[model samples]
Target: MTTAPADATVRVRYFAGARAAAGIPEETIRLAAGATVRDLVAELGSRHGDGLTRVLTACSFLLDGISVRDHGITLVDGSGVDVLPPFAGG
Candidate 1:
């Protein structure tokens, strides 16, 4: 197994369904320095349980205000990440 890097902090904002599932609007997460979005998702899943984990699978993320299309993208210290679950519209 690979070793995780040093810890780094990121601001995670949950919107709509994600917010409901996480039970919080936003939070700060401490993860490995080179952790990817995938890593963060897993961390969240392990913390929040099935409800949030389910929501997370369908959520999209914005890293520092830019859409994150790749889960492999590494996160840096003080970066901001938004978790947006699918929105129902008319």
Candidate 2:
């Protein structure tokens, strides 16, 4: 298996509908060493165009399973950031 750099930037992974909506399986996002989760969102929004604003508003962010609402939350390299929306069904 190929290995990534130790200080390599973050990698964003979208699941289920998010992946389809984003139109990409995954992305290697380049962020500042101490970029915040909010920063990542903005970066992604830029990449996805204006549609991202609406989509992102409906989604919840998770850092390694911990729900994150504070935009100021600092992100480190190799961290997992999940963009999740509410699930519906009976």
Candidate 3:
């Protein structure tokens, strides 16, 4: 596993099913300087377990309030990431 740069941090916010799966509303995750959203998901999967992995596959992500579809997008330090699982009704 890659280690986080000393000064890099990503705040992850979980909503709905994601929150239920992670058992928390939010968490601060450390990452290497150039880590991507995919990396963050991998780390979270490792930390949280398979349930989160499954939930994540059906979720949408937002980076600092902007919707992000590419998991390869590099993350900015001290940015906030929101994990939004699908809602039953629009």
Question: What does each candidate score in C-alpha RMSD?
Answer: 3.8, 5.6, 4.2
lDDT by residue for model 1 (3-64), tens: 76667799999999999999999999999778999999999999899999999999999999
Residue 24 displacement (Å), model 1: 0.6
List the candidates' TM-scores in order.
Answer: 0.90, 0.79, 0.90
lDDT of 3 at 3: 65
Question: Which residue runs of candidate 3 sit more than 4 Å off their true CA positions?
Answer: 1-7
lDDT by residue (tens digit), candidate 2, 1-90: 976534427777776566767888778887876678888988888888766556776788888778897879888777888887667788
Residues 1-90, candidate 3: write the lDDT tens digits: 986555459999999999999999999999888889999999998999999999999999999999998999998788999999998976
On TM-score, the stronger of 1 and 2 is 1
Candidate 2 segments exceeding 4 Å error: 1-8
> What is the C-alpha RMSD, rounded to one decimal, of candidate 2?
5.6
> What is candidate 3's local distance difference test score?
0.93
Clashes of each: 0, 0, 0
lDDT of 3 at 35: 88
